[model samples]
Target: MTIQTVAKQLTRTTKYRLNNGHHIPVAGFGVYLLPPAETFDLVYEALLQGYRHIDSAVIYGNQKEAAQAIAQFVKDHENVSREDIWFTTKIWNVDHGYDETKKAVEKIALEVKESIEYVDLILVHSPLTNKEKRLGTWKALSEFNHNPNNGVLQVRSIGVSNYGKKHIEEILAIDGPVVVPAINQLELHPWLPRTELREYLTKKGIVIEAYSPLTQGRHLNDPELLELEHKYKIPKAEILLKWSYLQGFVVLAKTSKKERIKLNFEVLPEGQGTNDPLQEGSNLGKIDLDPNILDALDKPDSHLVFTWGGADPTEYED
Candidate 1:
């Protein structure tokens, strides 16, 4: 199936309702590889520039700074509160077992509790651990969901990252009532579409969150993307983001620049009459891509096109 077949009419205020009834912003600002020292400032810039979602992780080593920025953003904006923004973090791979997961979560909760009241979502960072450990991690997160008061940290929802169909099936096959994951974030981009897995995820009602949507600026120069860049009169990065959004996937874009952050969030309709991509507008629109163009970009085996940092954990089996 074509990626944009299930595309929703999106606006700057558009959010996808999860299975748990929680709403996640269509666009999120990712904080991967951001320096701890500069994370607060950059994250604050993103929030100020109209990014309502901030995606961070325990392994990123800057969750504290990201939390501080969110806290400060809330305090400074009179109309905005904690609930106005979405904050997502993850448990590291080492914290996969039941006991270790509980302790790790409690520790992260304690660390960020002073900055923010609760996290919007917490994900199992990867599926590289053994099946037992993976289920244990989910169990720990499930318990936290069922009983938020059990610890200092409170998470509104739980999910998995880099999980394939088999991995998700394990979670679903758990012995008793389990909180089905609300999200399954993956290293998705034009090069690595993962179409089959996406179809399975859609059937199961799990939202696909696209990370590294731009291929970390590595494939922006592709002939087709560049042609589209010229045709749409926008950067290839925005073109890729629109592609992900059109596919009904929550897209996370990371950049340290303020203008780029604004560009990534404030996508305008065709006749907005503003050549300046940084100009703010409420009506968000999609980049018009023909079906053939979308098909051309769907290279399933291109997962090896680039390595952001680590291997694709979705391929890992233990």
Candidate 2:
């Protein structure tokens, strides 16, 4: 099907309700490569720029900064409460066992200076670790969902990142009742659309989070993307962001620049007024790309994973 045929309305207030009943904002600010020292300020700036979702990880070593920013932002904005923001973090590969994973979550809560209830989501960073360890980690996350002792909810939902179909199947086949993953964050762009994995997750009702949506700014100048940029009069980055939005995936855009942070949230068509792209009736809500352009962009070409290479779970299969 052509992209326009499937494209849906896009708004800054757009959200995807998880199977668990919690809602996640469609557009999130990801703090992947930001220095830990700069994370607090950058994240706080994004929050001020109308971003309510913040993606961080233990491996990224900026969970504390993100947490601090969230707390500070909520304090500053009277209308905004802790529940208004969605915070997501991941368990590092080193802490993959049941007890270790539990402790890891506790550490995150402590570092963030918020109770478990404040943390919206936690994910297994990847499936690169051994199978036993991976399952054990998931078990710990499941326990938190069931028992929130001392008024600490631990985490509202659990998910995985960079997991292929095999990894998901293994989790579903665990020996006993286990909490199904609610989301899977992956490096997705037109070049590496990962159509197979996307379809598999769609059938299972697992939400997909698109990371590195801009391909690390490498393909911004591509002739095809440039054409769309010119046609829509929007920046190449917005075109990429809109593509993922059109496909119904939560997109994570990372940038430290204040102006870019604000621009990233503005996806409305030209002349719609820049004050608020999320305003109703903005043409930016829907995108219509040519069928041939969609095919060229969505077709899998040479593998181009910018963040995690040689870490695909399928590659570990015997």
Candidate 3:
């Protein structure tokens, strides 16, 4: 991203203030490639550098490390309370439905060390909730929010991920989900901007969190990206990260390095904000995409991909 302001602007450090009263850091190190052994160290490094939010899910399988890092952070710093940490966990796709949803969330919360305190947020991991049991699953989450004991059900803000418009609408119509999902974690990057969905969500007051903000490191070689990297004197990756963030989206960036994590958090120069690589470039790629789990992550090479749902609102297109 390239931007211009006369006075010295604040560091590129940014956050997305969501509708549900939670502010998410626009940038933080990602952990998709991180093995369990390295997870804690990277997470500790992130928290020490002022990352308040950490996004993890059952599928990621690094929750234990992520949790340990947070607990250790609190022990290491009296000033850093658990309450100060905004931890996010998601229910997996296979866990969709009434009783399974209940058990899944319960297991995840407990896996993270059950606390009789407020949970930052919980998202329905995927949009593929069985049609017959979708409402019950959501209702189960709603109960989790209102439960007096706050056990496996300590979720505060409930939402969805990887859902498209039709799926979103279906969930929102369900009976009594008093809690509005505050976020829609989607696969967004300049090369594949979800323009239509972003516009819709902004109107609905749902914050969009961009996963794979760097496009899984696939766009770094593009000439347009290279040009911006040169123009801003930042790494092409930084240019991409800063662009997604500066454009007002909460970005979840993952890394397993102290230096790269620090480098990723560096402030971007001006003009990085207003420019859109996809907007003005005859790029190397096109936006025919699916919700792809990167090939290197032990998944099959070819799989149909789509968007994930978020905090449970409908009409989420793009």
Candidate 4:
């Protein structure tokens, strides 16, 4: 598609259709490590910057602040409503059993101070917990997802984060998955693309939500990335964001700075032209990065997961 076409579509509504038939905004703001004192302000700023999707987790311990920010943003903006925003939270590692997982979800809803009906998505934070506990957690999430008369905690969708191919196989090994995962949130970026896992999930119709799409600022100084930035005349961060978007992954770009938040969402301007060598027309808009550059960005490299303390599911055992 032409850059102008892409820009128009992004502005009109860039969304990914999940397996459950629900739609999530293609771009989201993550509140992974934001301090409780600043989570509300940062999330509120992000909403003003056109971020319709906000990602949080029970482990992050900022659900209340993020939720309050969303609530306040909706109250202030007449055109926006609770349904317009996509809110995602997760069950922590400590809460890995069936009962514990259910209670964790309820606790998140209570902390957010919103009806469970308003929470858009919930996830099993990680698969590093034992197989039994992991499966039990999935069972709890499935119950909430498939139950028609579920009270207060009506999770619209359930998914996993940091789950590998083996972890997914285990989930599917059940007689029949009550609710198929709609998405898998992972630490994805050009440096550590997780190509195998992405392909595995893609074949199953599960969307990939890319966290640390910017590599947590580590790629800012990389020679290859800097070359792309200079070649495209776009900021390094924008380059990374576009790379993830072009790969058909939902990108979660997090920043506490208001200006950076706005810049992250400004992937492209409407009807703008670029000097990018990849452009064949007058209007290049925001997607000016060259295809060859993207190819180089995807080249295999040493694994570099910047956050989460190197937790791997393969090492977990009962």
Per-candidate TM equals 0.89, 0.88, 0.77, 0.88
Candidate scoring better on TM-score of 1 and 3: 1
Model 1 ranges off by over 4 Å:
1-8, 268-296, 308-310
Expressed as tens digits, the lDDT of each residue in 104-220 for candidate 3 is 876776667643244667778666545566656677887887674764456667777766656666666767545666788877766556667667766667777778877676556
Using lDDT as the yardstick, the better of models 2 and 3 is 2
User: How far in Å is the alpha carbon of 199 misplaced in model 4?
Assistant: 1.0
- Local accuracy of candidate 4 as per-residue lDDT tens digits, 223-310: 8888877876878888888877777678899887888998988874433222211123332334555545676677565577776676
Q: What is the C-alpha RMSD of each candidate to the true structure, in Å?
A: 5.2, 4.6, 9.2, 5.0
Report the backbone clash tally of model 2: 0
Q: Which candidate number would show the highest lDDT if scored against the true structure?
A: 1
Predicted candidate 2 versus true structure: per-residue lDDT over 1-318, tens digit per residue: 234533434567666767677888887999988999999999999999888899999988888888889888888899998888999999988999898897887788778746214678889998877888888899888888767563544578889988889889989998777788999999888877888888888778788899988988777777878877677676788778777776667899999788999888875222211111122222334454443454445646545676665355434563
Candidate with best TM-score: 1
Question: In model 3, what lDDT does residue 117 have?
Answer: 42
Clashing pairs in 2: none
User: Where is model 3 more than 4 Å wrong at Cα?
Assistant: 1-15, 114-118, 268-318
Candidate 3 at 198: error in angstroms?
Answer: 0.7
Instruction: Give the higher-TM-score candidate: 2 or 3.
Output: 2
Better of 1 and 2 by TM-score: 1
- Candidate 4 stretches with Cα past 4 Å from truth are 1-12, 113-117, 268-286, 311-318
Task: Please provide, for model 1 over 168-233, each residue's C-alpha lDDT reduced to its tens digit, 9 standing for 90 to 100.
Answer: 999999887879999999988878888888888877878889898888877877888777777657
